[model samples]
Target: MAVSTRTSSIGGHQREPSGTLRLSVPTSYGHKRVLPLLPAFRARYPRVEIDVHVSNRSVDFAAEGFDVAIRILPPSDSSLVVRKLEDAAFVVVAAPGYLRRAGTPQTIADLQQHECIQFLRPASGRPLPWYLHEDGREQEIVTAGSYCVSDDVTGCITLLRHGAGLLQTLRFMVEDELRDGTLVKVMSHCAGSARPVSLLYPHRRALPLRVRVFIDFIVEKSTAWRRAKL
Candidate 1:
């Protein structure tokens, strides 16, 4: 769809897109990537005020009065209109400093011989499962850690940086580490497939102009991440 050049007016007055936008996002993704692009959105829509809640808890759009929400987790609520965004692949990683000290695992089964930081879902009190390519088949492997973070997949990166343990997380989250040699991919051969990313908003007859532009802005800027890096 093409955007119209026609000026928008309200009540006989030309108005710039303006309104308050309340939203929620996963903590680490919001802070590292999504939140950084916001200044550009602010420049485009000067009058739009944005309020964001960075949390692991699932949001109730109507019950909480939120306008939009971005989640890495699968959608559990069917009421909101969900627009899937970029998909991401996961990688098992460790810091170079840590690897030098503890040594690398030679095989997927060898991971048990090393320390591994794990992530858990606060909602279910269960650790997120790892799917590794093994013997020409994707197999599930349960990983454990001395420390765990609920809903914050990014924290695993921080821990891995400290030589806490090997952890599997989004490839994008550790790109800088991989590029600078601060962190090394542990098992590229057994890395997993892409996982869904999505944005959710109330299902309504029409979205407010302010909210609509934001949705467009985010989705438009997200094209690069949509490409397969694995």
Candidate 2:
């Protein structure tokens, strides 16, 4: 569902929101995207204390006492309200050195000829398939390589930087490297597939002021982020 981007006003005799906000988010996203925005959010909502929990596992909002969560995939539970934060685009990239040695791949079929780094799923302990858009549809392509990263997806990026192999990763993760020409994108024709990151919270008729403000803050920030990236 669409989240309203309206922010809470502190002016004109309105009560300033003050409380602890328990937020749960994925590790990578928490570090790269969310954490950096906290300082500004704090500046605006000075009295609101933020308690962040970074993990990949699904949280029990009621049992765990979490007020809000950010997830890459939508939850199955119907009781929780889901609002999309942003669509994270994944790109196929490799260091210039690695591409020079392996030869740049021009097509999706060409990826098989190169060493494609495999990112293992934390829950299943299996390699996560790469999703790419092709001919108006998304295709799941299972890739294999000499290197496998388990638990932490960022490990693949470390290997990628040292000319280890080709990697398909979230574009935001390698934005700096790509800008500096340290890494180069390949198979651009198949690169538009994106996964939606969403904000989740349990359904409640009346939410606390802190939670409501945090949700509005996140929605406002993410909308700007999407615009800036575009």
Candidate 3:
């Protein structure tokens, strides 16, 4: 059976197609994790238009009129529905040349002596803390480095590849380079500390068709993404 419905715009003065859904995700999403699911999403919903905004900063979903957001951090408002997607692992990586020059740091404490490349949040102008695990305990190390770059993971990867310094980055970001032996993981003891990835949507009595469809699609795709590794 086929059914049709219509919804008035928030302003209540105009009506538009409700089948369109807008999504906001980190720009890095396309390059690493979310890119693989695009073709499948399009094939499943040919009529649903997906508008993707690639950004590093937090998105105001209600104010900005985005239907859903895939984010790394949890939302502040209790009114939003947050779903845990996965625990993403991060590692300390350095280019082969960099390792050769400084020598690989076999222990977390050894990081104190090497140059580090830091990723900064442009909105806050603060460098992200490097997280590591040691002896069954997790530690957030405040690193001192001469080089700091704004949310440019690609540039950091480039710097690391050229033997610039050590970079704390998600494993997925450097998987290929590690596989090819261009980059090597440093501080094996601190390798597994990771953050949780999440999907968030505004709380509502009922979700519109478009938002509902996309959320379901994301859940299905992400599940498959995890299962494939097994």
Report clash pairs, candidate 1. none
Per-residue lDDT for 168 in model 2?
90
Superposed Cα deviation of residue 192, candidate 1 (Å): 1.0
Model 1 clashes, total count: 0
Report the C-alpha lDDT of model 3 over 1-230, residue by residue, as the tens digit.
33333324455554434466788777555567775676677676666777887778787877899888888756787878998777667888898888878888877778789888888876888997888787688877787788888865677788889888998888777878888899888776667666677888998887886677677777867785555431
lDDT (0 to 1) per candidate: 0.80, 0.85, 0.76
lDDT tens digits by residue: candidate 2, 1-230? 55332334345445667889999988778877899999898898898898999888889998999999999866899998999988889899999999889899887788889999998888999998988776789888888799998867778888999999999988878888898998889888897577889999999987888888888889988887687552
Which stretch of 10 consecutive residues in model 2 shows the poorest summed lDDT? 3-12
Give the poorly placed runs of model 1, Cα more than 4 Å off.
1-7, 10-12, 228-230
Shift in Å, residue 182, candidate 3: 2.7
**Stretches of candidate 3 above 4 Å error?**
1-18, 134-136, 228-230
| Deviation from native of the Cα of residue 201 in model 3, angstroms | 0.7
What local lDDT score does residue 66 receive in model 1, on the 0 to 100 scale?
A: 94
Q: What is the lDDT of residue 147 in candidate 1?
A: 80
